[model samples]
Target chain A: MKSTLDSKNLPILLPVLAFSLVLMIWELMVRVGCWSTDVFPEPLRVIISMGELISDGTLFKHVISSLFRVTIGFYLAIALGIPLGMLLGRREIVKHLFNPVIQFLRPISPLAWIPLSMLWFGIGDKPAVFLIFLSSFFPLVVSTTAAVISINPVFFQVAANFNFNRLEVITKIIIPAILPSIFTALRISLGIAWLVVVAAEMIAVKSGLGYLILDSRNALRMDYVIDGMIVIGAIGLFIDFFMKRLGRIDSVFWASATR
Target chain B: MGHIVIENLRKEYSNRRHFSRSPGSNPAEYREIIRVLDDINLEFEDGEMVSILGPSGCGKSTLLRIIAGFDKATSGSIRIDQKEVKGPSPNHIFVFQHSALLPWMTVRQNVGLGLRNIEDKARMEEKIKEYIEMVELGGFEHHYPYQLSGGMQRRAELARAIAANPDVLFMDEPFTGLDFLTHMRSREETVNVHEYIGKTILFVTHDIDDALIMGDRIVVLGGKPSRVKMERTLHFPRPRDFEKYPELGKLRSEVFLMLGVPYAV
Candidate 1:
């Protein structure tokens, strides 16, 4: 167990060592007056600020609120996006009719939806969630549609030849074949959800990491601003990691991780 | 009663948008449905091995697909065992040219995929093993399609097709991609499997030698909008050796003549 732990620690040792080196240099530069402490806080000072915010429950409040908006928005996107994708994929008439509309909407940036979201849903978690949903829905629908449409016709024929009914064909052959791509789409959409929600919260909401960043800036606290930015980055990375783990467990996506 | 009949069966695939019309034809005729079969009629008895020999462009594959109900005829009736085949039936098993084994499934899983209703795990395993051994793929049961060589993949497909125990088996150029020795072995395996299973086999191939080796009756189809041109019945003993034929060259010349291939006898 000790040896296994050491082996795993070896991979992380380089990044940990590099982080320490950078921090030491940062401290030295500040002490030498090459860079002002006001402009860039030291690692120790940033850690203290982080700890204080956490201890005072401000950080948790913002994180929890952000998570709530993102989750609701993300779940809504998945529920609606997947079925729409499948419908458009399987039916030629639907694809021909809706493709132009989807193409027109896809190119517009999620940030561009902010004013409309505000106008439509009002300034609150509603607007933020709406923005995240818009951001997440496009990629999910497009990827899943492509996946569903591109299923090998031979697989369908095989199922039919075996007298497998329509439900069985979709549930057994079609779904399993497209699962890898669907998971991929979900991951991409989740990333978009996180990104667009942050931007939306900065303009549309009063609580969340994005709001916290603006609040810190207004109070002239650069350290808290930087701390909020770091928290956002960490959360994004953590979510992506968990999404990938889920993909590996649920789908035949061995290539994505292994390669 | 378990038989197939095709009468005046025709198919026409519409042209793509880019290739709208010929230079000689009217441009307003943007859509062109190229007829693949024209007034073709044929019948197969139950438990018969019939080989369809035709040129590459001929509609042998289309005919098989039509009979299997994989594709619909533009205008025709196909009765399998006196019932019109509207869609794919559980009675027929098709072995495609490329094996068509799902890459994610192992040999055993691929074979047992069609038998999902067989809830008894031991029986499924037994049937899978039985067919796998019949096609000489018992050792490779755990291997995926990608892991197997081309010849092995064909064997796996054969094993899977036979495992379903269908009343009719449709094999379309299943051994064409194999090396000569592998092809010979695979051909032997196909014959052996057919004999053991006693299933009605509709085997399609361009190779006359393959037809002679495995078919109880061979139908030669040729020309555009292909139709059955010639039918020859093979009355040789079971498990006949190909090495003992004295008039093999003459027989091949006749096949070439039937297929419009220029050959000197």
Candidate 2:
């Protein structure tokens, strides 16, 4: 009973202690250095500002808006990327045709597309969501393609011997075989989407956590800026946790279980 | 109806060797064509269990794949039930040396894969259970391939193949990696399944003992460019006790001799 309790509590306890230590150090530094609230707000002041933002419903609005963009953009990337990746993975000619273009587009930062995005999609949520989509899409495609390509060829040979049609081969053999890798890609691309949405929002939109940070900075409210940053970090952690849970689903348990 | 006929079957793999040379050096040598199977002609009677025995790299697997319609022969034809073998069909199933059970699927799902086209769901479920029980994997229906032991994985794969209800089953060294006891048990189970279902089976293996134990007809293939070195029909009765029968010992020695391996009685 003691060992189980220790094991269960250790993970949550360690991180909590580390975070408290950091907050204590930050509070000490602010007091010792006598830094102005404009430059470096106290950790307690940031917490109070967070509570105020939460109470006023502004935090909910910003978080919900950002989440909405990520959900639509990331899922859109998935919808387009997985099938394209499957096609490119299976067909050498198609891969050869599109590979150079994909590689060229892959390394460019999604932020670099902001000017063009603003021009194409204009301001507000459209441009920000488009940027998030662009951020997630390339990684999803690359990872999905690699996943499909790396599947055991024996599986395909087995499918052939079983006389699986094209659809059956894809649905039964290809998709399931590549699902674990695809989930890895999903997690990675979701993180990228989350990161890019902040930058996208900072420039192209006016109502997300990124915008809140900018708005608070312009108004000389460092505590509110820190509050926004904390919210973003917390939400990012939640998203990653959700994805890790998704990777543990029963169908793809074989791949992750061994890991 | 599942009798297989192969005539003049040949497979050649061309290896193109790339040579890096200085400006004044000689040009690269021409590509070498290695013949894996040469002029292989064979026949399998309906419901017959035939073992194609060969040493490593002697084209035994190539021959099996060709017969199973997974690989193309350079110069001949294979016919099943008087129809030309064009490509892979649902009527025949090939079990590889490695278990081909999809790692993502459970044992039940893997077996159910073969029964996808069967419209009657109840029959499909019943067949899946029956085959799973046949391979003695009744309790492991929900276990994935990676979760099972090597022997169990092999049994699950056998169940998967048998559940397909194929007209012919081509097994390429299916029990090569199991422990001695597991191998013996699996071989017994294979023979039992063969007797029960009576599906035409082509078992490929490098082990002379495996061939002698399981096959009704043993085809020994060997040499650099492999061909049928010898073919012998075993008329021994069912459940032939190899340990007790002197005739079985003689047959074992004969097969070993054909394989060019020295043996002692």
- Tell me, per candidate, how large a share of the native contacts it keeps: 0.53, 0.89
Q: List model 2 lDDT by residue over B66-115, tens digit each.
A: 88888888889999999999888778999888888898889999999889
Judge candidate 1 against the unseen true structure and give its global Cα lDDT, from 0 to 1.
Answer: 0.82
Models 1 onward score TM values of: 0.85, 0.96
For all candidates, the clash counts are 0, 0
Task: Please report, in order, the local distance difference test score of every candidate based on alpha carbons.
Answer: 0.82, 0.89
Predicted complex 1: CAPRI docking category: acceptable
- Candidate 1, B20-125: lDDT as tens digits: 4456666758776788888788888888899999989798998888888888999989988888888787788888877688765678888887666788988878
Model 2 chain B poorest ten-residue lDDT run: B20-29
Inter-residue clash pairs, candidate 1: none
Which candidate has the top score in lDDT? 2
Model 2, span A138-215: residue lDDT tens: 998898889889989999989998878999899999999899989888998999999988888889788988999899
DockQ of each: 0.37, 0.75
TM-score of chain A of each: 0.89, 0.96
Docking class of 2: medium
